[model samples]
Target: MESFPTELGVLTCLMLLAASLWIPYIVGVNTAPAGSLPADAPDGFIRIPNPALHRPWVQRAWRAHLNLLEQGIPFAILVLLVDRVDGFTALTYWTAIAFFWLRVAHAIGYITGFARLPLRPLIFLGGWLCCLIMGYAVFAARMV
Candidate 1:
């Protein structure tokens, strides 16, 4: 059976990739009006230049996406480990959801150039904590 966390994680990655086009699309739309641009006009109507366009912001976005993608492996591992121990529970769902959503927040932060704030670090630490919990859970299960 497919793992829910891993599946959602894939969707998350797709969201990141799809989101990248939005800026460019906005740029294109900005060139148009009422959903259509004049034939002679160049595309630039809806697109605002992202501060995230810089090397640092772009790298941040990519790194965050990769980080989330890396987490996908562990997501599967968690489920596999869970099966070897207890079945899925509400807490498991919450934890995984929190992790996935935080990475998404990180993506948003990076894309919007908000990753520099304390909020970014907070969200990051949340993801790390979720991973740590899963690690502890696996180890604790083996011990039990």
Candidate 2:
């Protein structure tokens, strides 16, 4: 009956919802004219031309979602480790918040073409740093 950090729970839900956010774009791209698919297309296939390959915004959203998943795995592990060892410290809590917000920002930026604003990379790096901080906190807690 051990309690998990609230931030971790919230972030987990956000990550799952973020993954689903790409569905609309995927559906839009895959919804095609009747008989327009290539002859090679499998019968009853839902997707025709790969959305990411054909649409820039869809590509951006797909990549952003993938990036979130990539980062989320490590973040989840570290968050759990930290919770098991030391519960949530001020540093861990704030870092988790920062990471979650940055991820949201990154997704929005990518989807709306704001990622080209020169701040997107910085936002991504910020999220990475948050993960690094959480990792260090977990390590430090374990050493005590």
**Which regions of candidate 2 fall more than 4 Å away from where they truly are?**
1-4, 31-49
TM-score of 1: 0.54
lDDT of 2 by residue, 1-39 (tens): 977677677568766866686774675456555665555
For each candidate, what TM-score against the reference? 0.54, 0.79
Q: What is the C-alpha RMSD of each candidate to the true structure, in Å?
A: 7.9, 3.2
For model 1, what is the C-alpha lDDT against the true structure?
0.58
In candidate 1, how many Å is residue 14 off? 9.0
Q: How many clashing residue pairs appear in each of the predictions shown?
A: 9, 0
Report the backbone clash tally of model 1.
9
Residue-wise lDDT of candidate 1 within 25-63, one digit each (tens)?
A: 344334333634334444552244432433454445545
